[model samples]
Target chain A: MALRNASLSVNKGEILAIIGPSGAGKTTLLRLVNLLIQPTSGLILFNDVNTSGDDKHQRSLRRQMSLVLQYPALFDTTVFNNVALGLKIRGCPETVIKEKVDNMLAVVGLSGFEKRMVKTLSGGEAQRIALARALVTEPKLLLLDEPTSNLDPKNVSIIEDIVRAANTKSQVTVVLATHNLNQAKRLAQRVAFILDGEIVEEGASKEIFEQPKDERTATYVDGRMIY
Target chain B: MIYLGGWEEIGFGLFRALQLIFSGDPEVLRITLISLRVSGTATLLGAAIGIPVGASIALRRFPARTLLISVINTLMGLPPVVVGLFLYLMLSNFGPMGFLRLLYTPEAMVLAQLVLVAPITAGVTLSAVSNVDARLKEMAVSLGADPLQEVRIILREARLGLLTAVIVGFGSAISEVGAIMMVGGNLLGYTRALTTAIVLLTNQGAFTEAIALGIILLGLAFAINILLTYLQLRTKAGLFAAETERHHPVT
Candidate 1:
């Protein structure tokens, strides 16, 4: 499908990897799913519900889903507070909020970092915190935009582990956009290879990696510059 | 004799002014208190109205926003005398609001100052609110914050600049003589302030007292400037400290 016509369904507990070169409309697709930008003309259905002008519906859809931007922008607050922000917005009770925030931090491998400020965290730590912030609300759909592109190798692995663990423990449906092929193969169960805003290949990650139906997909997977 | 007075005369005037302040002369103290009252009330009233209006304009998109901003900018430079005359007419016997019978009263002076300072307060505050990081606004909305929460976040982030707006309104109100003189009737003991008193003394050819009042006015303005500067520095430091804590988490 073209950018205007493409549609993908993400099942619960599934990690859908959207792999593409630069300017393949991957980020734009994520933004459209997150309601960051409205498509020129298309329908965005969340949980089988059409989200258009109804602010309440849109918010409800977004409340159950969240997008972690490529650049993790932490609020100007301590890490504990940042992680607790989603609960705060939902008006969660103090006792429950405290317990849940503590658990989420521990889940993200940041058990003792509740009091730490977000600014001082390393790249890996910050991404984990960002993930924690998104997961604290327990979103059903988690959209990640190049979440590990900026990290070093060690940090990339750390982020991958965190992402994989989040899916396993929470069963949070995740859709990750990435340019790194290895990452997609390692973490994603299903992969969609896109070029120039069109999906060229889609199937189980291993299937797509083993047998490509399209030459463009083969070349892209083979690391020849196809753009 | 009129022309021969030099440094000695000016020095004597300054001495007498200091003596009057230290002695707490009833008229001088009373006028100072009234000036403070008028300026302080105006500043508060202006801020109360201006902050919300500015914030609304900054946050929401509506038709003719450009025209509204243009009008506010133009009003910021409105002459004091014009405001005075407008208020005078409005509060006069034949004007629409004349039933209040507020002309020449301290309240009238306050009204004039409010009108004069509101634009300054709004304009400054508008610029401050508009300068807040757009990402912050977007993030707040994405997090399900209501409109009021959005405003609170914006105001909290831009508190320093908002304070500057209040200080600017106060400075302008306290130093203006034309509007107060017109609406206040410039009475010797009833509505006189440092600015009106200086004007009255100058008109009466009491050059010594006028010069003395001028020195006091300068000192007051200087003190206000220093206080505002100190507050600005403190606020900036606080914002930076907050930002650092947010960006750089502690071990």
Candidate 2:
């Protein structure tokens, strides 16, 4: 019941935003792409290869992407270990893990926080750490679910900047899900409007916001779409 | 008539036990050491088997999982005498495992205690693992951790709870007398542990020696409890600190 007949694709290095009201299945759609959950009946093709066969192949495909949850879900360890987890799992050497983790922390404005316990971090700080952890692996695709839903303006702006930098500089494909229309306009190249588990309209971000083809999309962009 | 001079007798017995303790009574020390060794080995074996079983049950979903959990929970409170009897039958001369000739030996006592302890350890560990946030597991998977890596991460996060399980298993194994006495036969200078020895001394009218053994058992239990409790408190404090900071961020 969460999502049905929802199909979309992303270009390499392009940012796609999924905008919708609460219960519109934006999070569910993102989770499906990340392979955290499977569709009851659908095919997900990664790099033109169907991702629904063979456990080993699925795992290999999964390793090429990362997902950041709406709320930060950090390990109960130091910040360094959190960011180094993916690399370690992939059998990266310790020296490389340390260097990459350190650089990623610095990029997220958390320099010198390698030894800080994750539990002691503030919400914004924790979310930033989650981002750093996700991006440290340099995944081919990064899916975020309302990455800035509850953050303050300053933290929100900082996160937006980080996501932009990751897409432009690292060429990581990004799919961000949020209800914030302005955020979609600012960061996403293409936008999809989801309502009740279906994509109502999909187009370039500027066109979607400026001249929406669907009446519901226009009402949603105008901030008048009721739950 | 038998109860005459009860208070004075107990006071004198207490003083005598203390003297015996300080003077290094070989029999008492030997009994205490044997108790520790048997129970300690059983606890280690129990944890080795129990933690993984518990974690697997918690993480995997299959048919009869609820039934398995219920069975484990029931076994956690298994009567010591019943376990002793069950193992006695299995290890008896006419039984299938009789070729090992482990009956009435220290190993048999250890086996009995292991049976008791393993279920307690597993049940407690199951509860602990179940308490972990489901989102954490999802996040780990989303961050590219394979199934094995995901399990390792979950176990690491639940380390404190696992430690508690081991401690509880040890406590259960160390405190029981009936099961060990039945399987070990409480052989003098061999399998006689603190609990069995205390019973022997008390029955033989050596109240002073019994009281001394009792004091040592209490002291051991108290020490282990205190250490584990301190550790639990520290872990809880760290979690609480994180929770507070998360909810109330500094400007």
Candidate 3:
């Protein structure tokens, strides 16, 4: 019962934020979208194609998207290898991988840190590397689960700016799940408020946060407990 | 009936064994080298088969998986003598594999040890791969890793554990005497390994040679443990340093 009866649509190149309290199924929703976990029931269509099928099709669809987990699970390797993994999996040439990895690291403010071990990085640095790794492939869609959670203000700002740049410059569709209402307000073009495994309300970001149609959504956005 | 001379004989035997060790006695060295060769071959063969089977069992889900894992775990404790008996029957002249004429040879001993070692290797590898962070697989999938790449990534993360499996497998193979004794027949200058030689020398009342072989066996085990332990410690230290850096940022 992690997620149920939750229906929503995300336009291409749009930034959609899923904001809710803990255990509200925001992460579950993002996982569903990423096809990392399949819905027990319901159809998930990607570009008019159903994604729930054999592994080959799923893999093909997944290559066009990237999901960054909250904890940023980096491989036990160097930053360069971690960032280059997606491109490598796609069979990108060594020269192209090197160039793209370098560019991504630079964009994430980790220009000279390619050779450094991922385990040696601080939390902020590791999170940035995770973002760089996710964005390196220039995915058509980016799914972020609490990307800035537990980071200091500086790291949060850096991550938000990176997400913004990726969306605006690359036109990558983004579906970000976070508990921080303020972050939802700042970043998302549209917002969905989920509670108890269901989307309680959905609309434009400004209307959902400032003029929430549902009482539960209003309570959540107003900083009041709504369990 | 107190056998007061036994203590003096034991002391002298120890002295002679040390002398043989230091003097590079060819006979003693040959026995030690044969022991390593037989056991090393078994271990390599075991790992080559065991690791992939173990990792696959850990990563996949199907009916009877629990039963298979239980069978593997139980086999890890398989008695060496039982393996020896089973192989003895299989490789004997009247048996199905009799045409190969492998019985009473080093090859027969290796086959017996492989039976004893493969399960241990696979069992340890199963535990190691299972202990890897589950989120790592999910992350790999989200990052677009295909099935093969996902396995490669998981195996890389679980390298230390896999090495531990090899060490355990090798240790079991090298230290086992019961199986090899039954199959090898301990032919001198040919099939005789350190453990079998020790047994033969003791039975023939050549206490000095037995003691020498025992000491060399102990030394071999000690050397291997020391090297593998060093590697394990170095890996642990690197991981610890990385963890420390992750938790404490230089701001």
Q: Pick the candidate with the highest lDDT.
A: 3
Assess candidate 1 and give its lDDT.
0.81
What interface RMSD do all candidates show, one decimal each? 10.5, 13.3, 13.1
**Model 3 Cα lDDT, one tens digit per residue, B1-251:** 56767676767777888898899999888888889999999999999988998999999999999999999999999999999988888889997888899999989989999999999999999999999899888888887777877887787678789889989998998889999999898888888999888888899999876776777788898898789888876664343123211111111
Report the TM-score of chain B alone for all candidates: 0.88, 0.86, 0.87
How well is each residue in A1-227 modelled by candidate 2, as lDDT tens digits?
38976988888899999999989999889888877788899889888989886656777888889888889888887887788877777777777877998899999999999889888998899999999989998999999999999899999999999999999999999999999888999999999999999999999999999999999999999988778
Q: Check candidate 2 and list the clashing pairs.
A: none
Q: Chain A only: TM-score of every candidate?
A: 0.94, 0.98, 0.98
DockQ of each: 0.17, 0.24, 0.26
Instruction: Compute each candidate's TM-score over C-alphas.
Output: 0.83, 0.92, 0.91
lDDT tens string, model 2, B1-251? 46665675567767877887789989888888889899999999999999999999999999999999999999999999999888888899988888899988889999999999999999989988888899998887776666777787787778789989999999999999989988899998899999999888889998876776787888888887798788876764343123211111111
DockQ of 1: 0.17
Query: What TM-score would candidate 3 get against the native?
Result: 0.91
What digit string (tens of lDDT, one per residue) describes model 1 on residues A32-80? 8877667788788887778686665666676777678777766655687
Q: Candidate 3: DockQ? A: 0.26
The residue ranges of model 3 lying beyond 4 angstroms of the native Cα positions read B1-18, B225-251
**Best TM-score goes to which candidate?**
2
The TM-score of predicted model 1 comes to 0.83
TM-score of chain A of 3: 0.98
